[model samples]
Target: MLRGIYISATGLKAGLKQLDTVANNIANINTVGYRADITVNSGFEEKILNYAGKEVGKLEYGVNPDINYLDLSSGKYVPTGRNLDFALVGNGFFVVETPAGLRYTRAGDFQVNRDGYLCLPNGSRVLGEKGPIKIDNEELYVEKDGRIYNKERSRYIDRLRVVEPVDPVALEKVGGNFFVTAANNVRPGNALVLQGYLEQSNVDPNREYPALLESLRYLQSNARGLKVQDELLSKAVNDLGKVR
Candidate 1:
């Protein structure tokens, strides 16, 4: 009886965790460079089973919660017709200088900062191959090779710093459409920068939102099983133990 209760409790927890992940995906559906997370329900360890007091054998156990994986697929590109706005065509992320150090992101909505440096909307300086990109002239154009050009000055400015981690899953999310990766995992990527465009979030509400209904049903079933277990326990302890 107690084992049944434990299994039901694990199921309830797993359902709740799945629901939370789905909710997070829905919330970030509109966020740029956003990646949805998936919950992996790992099964429990092997357990010994006995029936009729005869050693039956080990049986498959139930599932528990906690494992999650990030979906690193890129989203559709949106053309904004702005030179500073950029989008990556392949697997890569743009580096930025944050107060906490260097962070990686796929969001390319950018503008020139007051100090003549190319920066994101929040003012974090965008990194180039040399360092923080400095764009003093308004007339700028980007080539397919990711090299920035100054049409007015008729010279090459700088190449955008695009890097990819050895394993994108190892990157940590630090809020505001950014991810931080280990310095060692940073490597040159094969992605081409598409000027005048931005990448949207890869979340698909049509498919992901339906998971909520399934999770809710699972949770309700587990709760019902747990209640039945509790009632059985009460009957066994109080009624069956009576001296009548």
Candidate 2:
């Protein structure tokens, strides 16, 4: 009875975790450059049950969430026709200087701060080869290779510092569509930059809705199993052991 209760509890926990993951994906469906998380579960090894020093049967403990990985697949490119907007065509992240230190992101919706520096919507300064890109003028052109040139003056400004992680799986999400990792984990990236585009979120509602329903069903099933085990335990301890 106790073993059954333990198994059901584990199943409930795993189901809740899966539900949360799917819900988050659905919530971020409209976010720019959002990457969906995928959860994987692994079952505990079956143990042989013994009674009076003799093998009886094998008992299985329920599964648990093993790990979560980002869906690295690229999202669709959206054209905004704004010069400051940028998007990567391949693997890479745009480097930005945040208050918490340097962070990386795929979001390319950028604006120029009052300090004449190009920055993300959250005010994180966008980094270039020389540091924060100072865009004193709006008439600038960005090349596919990330080079920025002053159109009116016809002078070179700097190249955007696009980078890729040495171990992408080691990167952690820090919210607001940013990712953080050790400085040594990054390397120069080869992704092409589009000057007037943004990447849409990679979440697919069609898949997430079905996953959410399935997780809810699993949770409800586990809850019922747990209640059944508890009632059986109560009956065994109270009614069955009564001295009538």
Candidate 3:
């Protein structure tokens, strides 16, 4: 019965974590270039005690909650008609220079800073093929393949640095649309860049809401199980010791 209580408790915890992930996904539904995270869970391995080669008992069914993996898929693209707006239509990430170092993101809403350098809303300089791109105050024109041209200067400034990591699982979200990856296996991406457009969040409400409701139901069931287990334990300690 104690073991049953522990199992139910673990189940409750897993359900809550899953629920939180679903809620976060819904919350970022409108964010630009946002990807929803998925909660992964693993089951506890049964522990069997052996008494001099004879098995005594086996433990079962307690779930082990695991990490959240980013969904890495592309989102819908909305045309902004802004010269600096960009969107990636395939697998890739735009590199940005943060204070911590280079971070990757899919959000392409950019602006030319006072210094005439292309930067994101948070002021992170957008990295180009040669490094941080320097521009002379001019009208910006970017081709589908990421080549940037300064209309006023009549010169090609640089190429936008869109890279693909070896594996998406190695990337971790530190907030906003940025992702940090430990793997150094990054290469130039093949995705086409759409200028005058921005990528929207990838969350789908119809799917996430149903999943959240299902997790809530599972939590409620586990709560009922906990209540039943407590009642049985109470009977075992108190009623079982009573004399008629």
Q: What TM-score goes with each of the models? A: 0.87, 0.91, 0.88
State the displacement of the C-alpha of residue 3, model 1, in Å, after optimal TM-score superposition: 1.5
| Candidate 1 overall lDDT versus native | 0.84
Candidate ranking (lDDT, best to worst): 2, 3, 1
Model 1, stretches more than 4 Å misplaced? 44-61
lDDT of each: 0.84, 0.89, 0.87
Mind giving the per-residue lDDT tens digits that candidate 3 earns over 50-165? 22355545445677568998888778899999888899989999999999888999999988888988899999999999998777567788888999997664788899999988
Q: Which ten residues in a row have the lowest lDDT in candidate 2?
A: 45-54
Runs with alpha carbons beyond 4 Å of true place in candidate 2: 45-60
Using TM-score as the measure, name the better of candidate 1 and candidate 2.
Answer: 2
Candidate number with the higher TM-score (2 or 3):
2
The true-versus-predicted C-alpha distance at residue 58 of model 3, in Å, is 6.6
Q: Tens digit of lDDT per residue, candidate 2, span 73-114? A: 999999999989999988999999988999999999999999
Clashes of 3: 0
Candidate maximizing lDDT: 2
Model 1 lDDT, residue 194, Cα: 93
Model 3 scores worst on lDDT over the 10 consecutive residues at 44-53
